[model samples]
Target: MPRPRTGRRVRTLLAAALTTLAPLVFLTGPAQAAPAAAGAWTPAPAPVVSHVETDDPVVFITIDDGWATEEAAGARQLLLERRIPASLFLLPDAYERDRDYYRTLLAHGPSRIENHTTTHPDLTTLTEAGQRAEICGARDRQLAAFGDGPRLLRPAGGATYNWPYHNADTRTAAPACGAEAIVMWTHDLTTWGSWTPPTPELKAGDIVLLHMGPTLEADLTRALEAADAAGLSPAPLRDYLLG
Candidate 1:
């Protein structure tokens, strides 16, 4: 042995070994983490659907907004009594005013409350962030109140046509806000004041649109009758949409 190794010499040798290994330690750390970092992904936008193509004898009923307390009672009664699984796309304020109304419908019937935004705004006109706020804000409120989150989003405002006002941003924001589909309609039967829009001959996989107001009860009745005439029954929209 060349002179018993001094403590200082031993320390120096150990330091050199450690320095040589340090680059590998740093490199391995990042290499191990790279997979996880690369796995991160953003969700794709939800699809807009005006109709579902199916051969089953089924129709989808969707009601929008939550206003018209007295007028809505008849509709509520019909829904509960008939056990129609209508998708209620409601505004936050509408249900907040009378949570019990929706709660009871959900408790007793096959109906479910879905999202129509906090304030009904033309989603096509809103910025991406603004549209997200409206869509996600409604989802949060509904989840808090009902212990259930809305899976479908119906963009607000459509006139003389079935599809609601929406844009590319609406589709992108909808999925980000937890909506699976941006629901449009094949038939809009909303009645305004004394004017009742004519009902179309119902068909399988048709999406029927109605509103909560003075004519809801009548509209619901007519829709059911039309569905019956077409040999279609009202089916749960969520199940059909997902399937």
Candidate 2:
């Protein structure tokens, strides 16, 4: 069930505050043992997926995770009815929570599941082995559930470290782990509330990111409307990438 919006807002604010405060508290404490200068670990460039570019009136809609209950089903139905294509970035564990639910989503036309890690973690902070495990494990689980492998990956939280975070080089982990492309959002509606859809602009090639929770249907509907207004039609991410 979706948490009350009021409560969720308060919790989000508190969590942000605590995240900001924790580092200060740690830094002010008595001098902890200074660690040796660590060897620089460089992040490899993220793989470039061709689907991100185009002059056509289309946008890529990507939904993350499998936690949405009826909200997801409604969104799937809406998308199918509209003949819109979308991609799902699934956290394998979450999908496991309700295998039948995810299968229902797959049964809906114009959708594909992609990897979002077995356990969502900061890949840059994780050891190479840890990263591989998280990435590959999710891929394996999705394959078992859906009878196919994911070709794209999106990192948790969109946060990166290990030097040059957004540099193309920093994104190599996913592809090396088997994903053919890495997806990042071009616009964020996080401030409007999770259930509220952002005003979508029907650019030739816009990649819109959304969560699986409340307002997903509303958001996608708004996005589709916006695309229509801009004289664009949504197309498959695969069309651009594999073509």
Runs of candidate 2 with Cα error greater than 4 angstroms are 1-51, 158-170, 190-200
Residue-by-residue lDDT tens digits, candidate 1, 1-243: 122235335434543453354322211010011122234422344555667777999999999989876668888998999899999999999988899899999999999999998888877677778999999999999999999999889889734333337665675577678787777788888787788888798878888999988889998898999999999999998886652
TM-score of each: 0.80, 0.71
Worst 10 residues of 2 by lDDT: 25-34
Please identify model 1 stretches exceeding 4 Å from their true place: 1-41, 158-164
TM-score of 1: 0.80
Model 2 agreement with the true structure over 107-137: per-residue lDDT tens digits: 8667888888887766666655567688888
Error of model 1, residue 5, in angstroms = 65
Residue 62, model 2, lDDT = 82
How many clashes would you count in candidate 2? 11
lDDT of 1: 0.77
